[model samples]
Target: MSHSKSFSLQKIINYIGGTLIFFGVTYFVYSNWLSLNDFFKIFSTLGVALAAYIVGALLYLNKEYDEVGSVFLMIAGLILPVGIFIAFKLTELITGINNLSVVSFSISLVAFLLIFFYFGRIILLLFTIIFASLLFFAVMELITTKLNYFFDDLIAYQLVVLGSSYILLGYYFDLIKKYNLTGSLYFFGVLFILSGSYFLSGILSFDSTLWKMIVGVIILLSFILSVPLQSKSFLYFGAIFLVLFLVDLSRRLTPFFGEAGWPLILISLGFLFILMGSLIFHMQKKIKK
Candidate 1:
């Protein structure tokens, strides 16, 4: 217990220090941006990233200082993309917000993933996920702009696909006993799935029975999966989205059913909420057992 506590505390301290250093350097660069020459501008960011990465690699060789080494690595992770972006911009290789962002993020993603594989550093996996997400968005944006292929619910479909992938990846991570990574992926996965489904359900647009049915099924599955996954996040988000769906359904029905149906809607939703609460409570008990 003591060792675990110490490990946790050390990680917290290292992360805090890393964050401060990143921000401090960022501020100094921003403050001196105009005064610095082109060389300094490029060096300040890339130079720091390189130095931090080298130091992190050296420190990571010692088991006792691995967490501190991770802090430096994280600093590298945070700055490397900015460095790449700046370098590309300065070289006139990137003119605007186009494929350049994708290229930069792809490089960062590959770098972090390779480092993680070599060192087995979980922290690098965080960067891997972040850069991968950025790359996905950049690619999507490029497609939207270049192809002019933006369609209704196009982004929603993309989110659903991404969310499904994240959910599966979370399960894989859980199988490997990477609980922290699992939780992060699960949280974002559910959020993206629910958010995309909500929009696709036509809550903000026209009513569609098909989408409503699909969303309802998704919510039901979320609740069911919670027990098997041992993930409260799935349960909680399921309930939250359930409420939102019900409220939206009621609003959509208000005009059709008239004011007389308002009372019925409220009473029905009330009963439904009670029933769901009871079911969830039982599920939680079963999960504990």
Candidate 2:
């Protein structure tokens, strides 16, 4: 197929896959609304493995358009299912095998090894860092017996680290027209931001009042930096952060205003949305001109 035709087909496939996945998750959640914990326990690992396989298959099918990393992802897709199944069986047979941690560590390690083989030293190094971070968390959880706190904190730290890596990677990819890099950057950046928000919320457990203000300030600064970047990707990031900031601020202020605070929150959200939309439009027009 011609490049354009191939691109169009890939786009269609992606759209279909995304739609199906969304509906699948929604259906699953709705069906098990009363037993959400059980639902997650049964499906979360399997769901992730299945999704990875689908993604890898898609990449492999578009091998002509994909790079070495795509091939690696395909390999990962294949290995994930097998790895999970093996981990499950091993845990069942063994005296003290934690299936969840083992499966996660195995996948991360395999991914690190695969990327190392394909992309050389730099990518290998990056994957190694990711793998090690995950491994450290898994080991800590296994040893400490009450390492949930450490695990939670590590999760937040990983988000910041990984998210920063994505931004940097995306910057370089955008500069060089590397589509894979662009996609990776966007995916990881969003992951980082959302995870960071959750992490901040967790930190607020100690002192809600103080941490709320600090998080709000940090998020505001992030939005300011993102908005001025003149990049669609960055603008989107900024908009998300702005929305999160507004939500956080509203939640914090609601107690002070009692019932009246609800309307204030709605108005705040509406205004923020309008401001972000206008900013994005203005930026796009400037880019066109």
Candidate 3:
């Protein structure tokens, strides 16, 4: 086959495969809509598996590097089923075990180590560690039956953990620069930020003063970092977060400013929105140029 013909064929295959995978994930997620907890487990397992297969198939069809593609497909196939099974078994075990906390910790720890060995990537390894650490703490909470500082602030804990995980994953992508892998990393980064915001809100629980300020700063910083990385999606998302932060800040300081606080805050937010929007637009133009 001529090189041009081969490239065209590969592109077609990639397009078709990607469309199928997208539909499959949409079906999976839509099937369990409105029930996040019930659907997410199944969606993640099956969706990831489908995505992996599609990616592998695209790579194979492209004939760019069949060997590497095969490896990726195989890993995806293997991990999807196995991870789901383990999750189910762990859920069952957690129910039966007298020391549920210890069981959870041990399982997460093992999973962490296994991912490190199998993936053999520093970025993935760090994510595994963060996941394990969160699980460890969650288990500890269960064991002690204490809903004290940490448990009381589940949102904060979840945000910090998930956000940290994404930051690490993003760092990893920055190092590797593989197109597919970088796409996944960016997806995860956006997800973490959105989830982390909810967590921050939960932690604030009416006392939004301190938490709002902290999260605002975090959101601004996240936007700045994403710009240089050429992640328009994250930059835009961060801009949205910046608005939310300002709104929260204004609401918190309402007592001092009285009725004027609302308009002032909105005006401030409008300015920020324009500023960040301009920055993102300029950054993207620069990259293209």
Q: Write the per-residue lDDT of candidate 1 for residues 121-166, one digit (tens) a residue.
A: 7888888888998898888888888987867887787788888889
RMSD, each candidate, Å? 2.0, 8.6, 8.2
The lDDT ranking, best first, is 1, 3, 2
Model 3 over residues 1-289: C-alpha lDDT tens digits? 9988987788567556655654665565567655657346644664576567567556666555664455445445334443444345545633533244445445545644564465454433444554465565656566546444345666556556665666676767678764235545565666566656556564324555456556667666766766566676566667666666556556666778787877777787788778877887776674422
Which window of 10 residues has the lowest lDDT sum in candidate 2?
69-78
User: What is the C-alpha lDDT profile of model 2 across 1-289, one tens digit per residue?
Assistant: 9998987787667546645654564566567756756436335444555555456445545555454334344334434444455445544643344446655666666765764565443434454545655666566557655444434365666567667666776677667764444555555675575557556565324345555565566555554554443345545665666576577667767889888889978887888789878876776654422
Report model 1's TM-score to 2 decimal places. 0.92
- Candidate 2 differs from the real structure by a C-alpha RMSD in angstroms, to one decimal, of 8.6
Highest TM-score scorer: 1
Q: What TM-score quantifies how close candidate 2 is to the native fold?
A: 0.54
**Which runs in model 3 stand beyond 4 Å of their true positions?**
1-150, 176-180, 201-208, 253-268, 286-289
Please give the CA lDDT of all the candidate structures. Answer: 0.86, 0.57, 0.58
